[model samples]
Target: MELENIRRRKQELLVEIQRLREELSEAMSEVEGLEANEGSKTLQRNRKMAMGRKKFNMDPKKGIQFLVENELLQNTPEEIARFLYKGEGLNKTAIGD
Candidate 1:
């Protein structure tokens, strides 16, 4: 009786793992489909723009000092990100804004 119970529990665990794996597989497939359909060329352009944005040295310490001195730039990432997003069309949300 003990051996049978152990076997049954093992089988249940195997089934659970299989089901979870299938769910993950399906989710991945859906993501792939969405990625394929959602403006690939636009994405490529966005990637290039993002690469270029690295050159735009915001230099937090310097920027904050300048902002504090000039009273123009904001004090938070959210504010800075929104300004950049509107001005440059970059993704503020992706940067945790």
Candidate 2:
């Protein structure tokens, strides 16, 4: 009786693990889809303007200091990221004004 119970529990754990693996596979595919679709027109324009460069060369600390001293930028990092990636208001709730 004890051996049968152990076998049953082991089978149950194997089934659960398989289900979790399938879920993880689906999630990874969704992430790949998002990455493939991330290149919008505005982003493509920005890439072209950079002349094949992958990343910016500016120092973030100095940039922040300049913005603060000149009062040129007012938004938070999250808000600025939304504007940059064009995902603004995507996750906003209806109750959020």
Candidate 3:
């Protein structure tokens, strides 16, 4: 009788251990997901802050002239404008002529 009771108790302990292991696995998955989400948010916030700090408000025409007068750029104004606005989805109208 005592042996039967010991076996039943062992079975119960095994079931409890399995339940704990499943709970731990789910908790670990949730932690990993939260960590990944936090990392992504941090990266986006950093990009936004960097972009906010780096402002290029120069007029394209004046910028081109300055570069040429300073001997800093050898390209023509048209070429410089094309280079600046290339792939930016902006047209010459945005530059006010």
Candidate 4:
């Protein structure tokens, strides 16, 4: 009778262990999914640059001459912003504005 009880207890323990293992696997899967989602949600360099684009759009003028001269106007606002403080001849040396 005692041996039978021991066998039954052993069976119960195995079942409990298996259930715990399954729960752990599910938790690991959820962690992996969360990591994947976080990676996907990461912002691209272009998006970050776009956010910083507001500083470059200096003048209100829009034309071929403006584009050729400024060069920033040729691209999107983001691009213009990245190159805002960069490069030479951004400002004209004219005596008057």
Cα displacement (Å) at residue 84, model 3 = 27
Assess candidate 2 and give its lDDT: 0.52
How many residue pairs collide in each prediction?
Answer: 0, 0, 0, 0
Error of 2 at 42 (Å): 5.6
Query: Candidates ranked by TM-score, best first?
Result: 3, 4, 2, 1
Q: Which stretches of candidate 2 lie over 4 Å from their true place?
A: 40-97
Give me the candidate number with maximum TM-score: 3
Instruction: Look at candidate 2 and give me any clashing residue pairs.
Output: none
On the 0 to 100 scale, the lDDT of residue 29 in model 1 is 100
lDDT of 4 by residue, 1-97 (tens): 9999999999999999999999999999999999987776564433433333322234323322354354424566664444444533333322112
How well does each candidate superpose onto the true structure, as a TM-score? 0.41, 0.43, 0.55, 0.49
Q: lDDT tens string, model 1, 6-67?
A: 99999999999999999999999999988887878677656654543433344434434454
Model 2 CA lDDT for position 31: 93
- In the order shown, what is each candidate's alpha-carbon RMSD? 13.1, 15.8, 9.9, 10.0
What TM-score does structure 1 among the candidates reach?
0.41
TM-score for candidate 3, please give it.
0.55
Weakest 10 consecutive residues, lDDT, candidate 1?
52-61
